[model samples]
Target: MIVQQRAYQHPHQPSEVRLVVYETAAAARRVEGMPDDAGYLVTEEWRGAGKVIKTLGFFPDRTPALDVLSARAQELEGQLYRPVAPAA
Candidate 1:
């Protein structure tokens, strides 16, 4: 007799936020059409299993946006990921 064991996959958890900051108004506008005076645009996105779940944005500042993102991630038991270098 031969027996095989099946692999187990973890259940899908709440989506995580990948925060990206666009330092320049031009770059932010190119990506999300934000106004030039926006100063900065912080994008929050969730991409998992080869699909994008959701994408949101906050304008003019990164620090406060990140604070809110962190709180939301904590509430949802998810994680926040960001790029090491600033966007051009």
Candidate 2:
């Protein structure tokens, strides 16, 4: 399930990408350095019928995660990624 999510519009394209933090049954096996207690994940995804496009990395904490997203978000939006609710 999605624990956190944000969206960004492509400055030149007709699509948006989401920066998401989520949990899954096999979260531990997807990446190395993922602490057993983190229980959360971040990925680079393509929009679809709720499918992940790729695994970026794992984070034990969120601060650094935001930093990574922030940099990418700034390029398109000139600010941090805007928070958005996950689709149900």
Candidate 3:
């Protein structure tokens, strides 16, 4: 007789803010327009603690978007993942 083990698949976590790094705004614009939703993507250059510099892209709505960012920031703290980078 033989026993078999089952594999597990993790659920995809939905993010209101899309974290990405783009050299040009045009490329980022392309992704921003992909979603025909109401919210807009806020772009920024982030240069904080990390291996390499990264750009962030996120959506901020009148309610959920920014609210979630704030709460998550508080919860994650040093591990916070902003969609954009800070200005130089």
Candidate 4:
């Protein structure tokens, strides 16, 4: 289950991007009743003029996912990438 989501836009690009953070595997099964083999799946979608141009996926622990997202946001020069909130 996606616990949080955010949208971003780069200053130099015409694309709008989205970042989605999913719940941990254990929480997924307990909360959503879905079995997730991957520890956590983070996804980024790049859209141009309301159309998706590219999509990237990463399966990493929560910490690594934050690092990856920060790097990606910097690389894209996006306006913002919200920090991940601690899971309750």
Candidate 5:
């Protein structure tokens, strides 16, 4: 099973973070297969034990994915993150 949570912030909130969890590759794959608006997908594998288990998908970039999550965060009590353009 996968669970999503909002990242914590204090003092001055810089950006918002949303957690998308998955237990199996199939689940992660489903999320990956989701539309491009689901943010950039970064997979992190657990290798502490001899057997490899669990893969996590992190949508860190501010893309369509961020837009979708940002809305959800706002509704679910998540911090807001606005992406700024780099200075030339």
Candidate 6:
């Protein structure tokens, strides 16, 4: 289930990025030897090079998910993440 959706504008480039926070759960039935990757899913999308998708992380709860989104917004605004290396 989706909890929140946020859009951010790039400070340097004329581009917009969309963020989605959603909750996911493991299936009741067994899927063999699969990892139980169940939790809040944070995804980012931008219209560059045919729609790029980046998974921020799998948070345990809503607060941390939103916190990440907030920090990402700040980073996009050139107030943070300037010193960080470029994402792969």
| TM-score against native, each model | 0.43, 0.54, 0.32, 0.52, 0.25, 0.66
- Tens-digit per-residue lDDT, 20-80, candidate 1: 4444544435544446565444444554465453334445665765565455445444322
Question: Scored by Cα lDDT, where does model 1 land?
Answer: 0.42
For model 2, residues 1-88, the per-residue Cα lDDT tens digits are 6766677655455445777777645434644555556544677665655555565555666666656656655664654334345444
Task: List, residue by residue over 7-80, the lDDT tens digit for candidate 5.
Answer: 42323554333333322332345444454343354322222223232323445443544455445546435333
lDDT of 4 at 32: 48
Of the candidates shown, which would achieve the greatest lDDT relative to the real structure? 6
Please list the C-alpha lDDT of all candidates, in the order they appear. Answer: 0.42, 0.59, 0.32, 0.57, 0.37, 0.68
Give stretches of model 6 more than 4 Å off.
11-14, 28-37, 79-88
When superposed on Cα atoms, how far off is each prediction in RMSD?
A: 13.7, 4.7, 17.0, 7.0, 11.7, 7.2
RMSD of 5: 11.7
Which candidate, 3 or 4, would have the higher TM-score against the true structure? Answer: 4
For this target, which candidate reaches the highest TM-score against the unseen true structure?
6
Clash totals, every prediction: 0, 0, 8, 0, 3, 0
How does model 6 score by TM-score?
A: 0.66
Q: Write the per-residue lDDT of candidate 4 for residues 12-80, one digit (tens) a residue.
A: 565667766665654345534444555655667656666553334445566666666566767655444
Clashes of 6: 0
Give me the runs in candidate 1 sitting further than 4 Å from their true place: 1-17, 26-28, 31-33, 78-88
Measured with C-alpha atoms, the lDDT of residue 9 in candidate 5 is 30
Question: Tens digits of per-residue lDDT for model 6 on 1-88?
Answer: 8787776654565445777788878663354543366767787877545678888977777799889977776776574222222223
